[model samples]
Target chain A: MVRYKAIIAYDGTNFNGFQRQSTGRTVQEEVEKTITKMANQRVEIHGSGRTDAGVHALGQVIHFDFPYERPLEKMRFGLDTQTPDDVAVKSVEIVADDFHSRYLVKEKIYEFRVDIGKPRSPFRRFYASYFPYAVDVAKIERALPDFLGTHDFTSFCATGSSVEDKTRTIYEANVTVNEAGDELVFTFRGDGFLYKMIRIMVGTLLKIGNDRMPADSIPAIIAGKDRNLAGPTAHPEGLYLKEVRY
Target chain B: MVRYKAIIAYDGTNFNGFQRQSTGRTVQEEVEKTITKMANQRVEIHGSGRTDAGVHALGQVIHFDFPYERPLEKMRFGLDTQTPDDVAVKSVEIVADDFHSRYLVKEKIYEFRVDIGKPRSPFRRFYASYFPYAVDVAKIERALPDFLGTHDFTSFCATGSSVEDKTRTIYEANVTVNEAGDELVFTFRGDGFLYKMIRIMVGTLLKIGNDRMPADSIPAIIAGKDRNLAGPTAHPEGLYLKEVRY
Candidate 1:
């Protein structure tokens, strides 16, 4: 068997999520269906990770095996044409026979978007979370550094999560204001993430940024190790799986 | 009766057009429905002009008469709450009883957008017209001056138009490239425009920019006084009724 790796991007507006289920449209199902049609064989593709419903992806990686080999460009173009318009195989390459997308991940990055300082607009209704209240960027910037280290992120993960491991190393976290100053972007890069970790973290940071929470509230939230201690989970539509590095 | 004037804006993605239609949804119907409900009386509103289906507007003017007077702010807010998310009333005020939206208009400006130099995607599906090929901005600029002076403009008007007076004066016509240069905006300001006039003019300019027509082709097309001489009408989504000046 020959292993093939591909980078994918999707809008996620109409998708149930990145994983396949018995029903509903999904990014995984769309790509897998196209690959099956192109290769004339049922192929189960493994993604680096699963993004929640309404979460977008710009560089979600996946791997699958096939019985035969062909020109890489031909396979990529063939899959692209067959897949729906919302999902695309950005790049594809032949890899080692044993390569696995999920097991080999070294790091991941996610971005959360906040649309603020404008009248609620219909243009960004599906892509951004509109926050009408004023937020202090300096306060948010000052609070993000507290997230930059290995910690037990049980407070950030959603309740009833199945994973036993609650610890993750956050390599970098920062808040960037767009030039127009109407958008606030929270970007997180880490060794790995817990379920709904970034959204919870962003929500907590937004609370601090909006002066609802003190800037120094992070240590107590982390020390509590309780999901209820953190702020609410940000909306899924504002979250994007930005990158996965191997 | 008290005359009221409003500046309206709409996405126009779902509407049939601005004029009243028997079946499909239209801007006129949406506003009239809301106003009728607000006033509890049958009312007739006149718009500055009609916009084709799928067109957008940033500043469309309209006028109507209501028997009673209320705070302008209250009326504007009431209309906005009743309209769909894609449309809004930017401002409203009381006007002279004799004022008419269409009859008193002095000039109008329209802008058309083209998204070029990127793989076509669903994100801009309703907002812009995508053109993949390269264009010569200088060639288009050279051709625009020919549209500035008063002319019959028969070539730029759609066939089957019933207007007998085809002469119109174009005060300004220019092509602007955005800072990214990936977007080319054609802005036209004229005393008045005939049916499909701006769309056909932009189409002809685009053809010239793409090397399909010579930069000097404008004069002959105008002198021919025939709609068949001009390029095909551009897509409706890119057109916007930017402003109606009094």
Candidate 2:
């Protein structure tokens, strides 16, 4: 058997989530079923992590083992064509047998897009979160530096998370507007992220930008380690798993 | 009664078309239904023209008569809130009693987008038509000039169109790649267009770009006035009714 590593992209609007479950459609189930059908046997695939429903991905990593050897190009083409239109296998390559998609030291980048236009555009309703209220971009910019270092992100995590250690190192955090001037894009790069941590951070930053919360509250929010002190979780539609680097 | 002119935009992915019909859901039906509900009476709206199913619009104009006079802002807000998420009313204004949405139009601008990238992107499936074949943009640019000025375009018009004249003046025709360099955007500004005319023109231009047809065949195709002489009609997902001017 040969181990293969692949990078994939998916539009998560119709999916329940990245993980397979007993009910509802999922990216994992769709991919595994397609690969299994091609292999003529049951095959399991492993993802770097699970992304919630309505969250898109530009470069998610996965690995699986195949019973027979085939050209990497043929495997990529076969996987891309057999799977549904929403999921695409971008690239595939042979990998070491010890390579694990879920483990090994790595970094991740995520992006959140918000439409700041006055009247919500119908074309962008599914791809971006609508925020018509007034917001000061400078305020959000000033507060982003506080999130650039290693810290316990307990206050930014959702309640359902069971992980005991909430500490993670953020390598980069920044916000920028597209050329159209109608969207605010927030990007975060980190060694790891807790459940819904990026969304909570975006929600808090939006509040600060809108003046609903103080601009200098990030340090205190992290030190407080209270989930309630942070802002509400942002909508999942605007979130994207941009890249995973190993 | 007062006449209200409104600019509307719709995603068109879920709608049957812009015109009202007895069958599937349409943008006109959704807007008229929402406005009638607000007025508490039966109402009808007139559109600039009909757009086929799966064709989006950014500036579709419509006019309707209302029994009561309400603030334009309030009416716009009401229509926007009541209509389905796929439709949005961009602006509303009171027009003269004799103003008509269809007859008074002086110009129209349409845009067609083609994704020339490899391995079609999942995020753009609904918004753009993917063409993975090799094509030369300069060949397309050379052929675009022939489409300008007044000409008989029966060869470019789809067969379902009943319009007899088939003659239209083209004020502007151009093609440009987006900043990402992955999409080719074709823009055509003209007095009017017949059924699927823009799509047919794009299809023909793509053939010329791909070297499947002579780059200089547009003039002969126009003179032939035979629909079979033109290339296949492009996909409707890439076509958009950009604007209608009075």
In the order shown, the candidates' DockQ scores are 0.30, 0.77
lDDT, candidate 2, at A246: 85
Residue-level lDDT tens digits of model 2 in A7-120: 999999999989998988999999999999999999999999999999999988999999988998899999998999999899999999999888964899999999897568
lDDT of 1 by residue, A1-246 (tens): 689998887888899999998888998888888788766899889999999888888788999997799798788777766788777666789999778899999999999988884344545556777786889989998889999899999999999999998989999999888887878888899999999999899889988988999999998999999998999898898888889999
Residue pairs clashing, model 1: none
Candidate 1 interface RMSD, angstroms, 1 decimal: 2.8
**TM-score of each candidate structure, all chains considered together:** 0.86, 0.98
Q: Chain A only: list TM-scores of all candidates.
A: 0.97, 0.98
lDDT minimum window of 10 residues, candidate 1 chain B: B117-126
Top lDDT hit: 2
Runs of candidate 2 with Cα error greater than 4 angstroms are: none
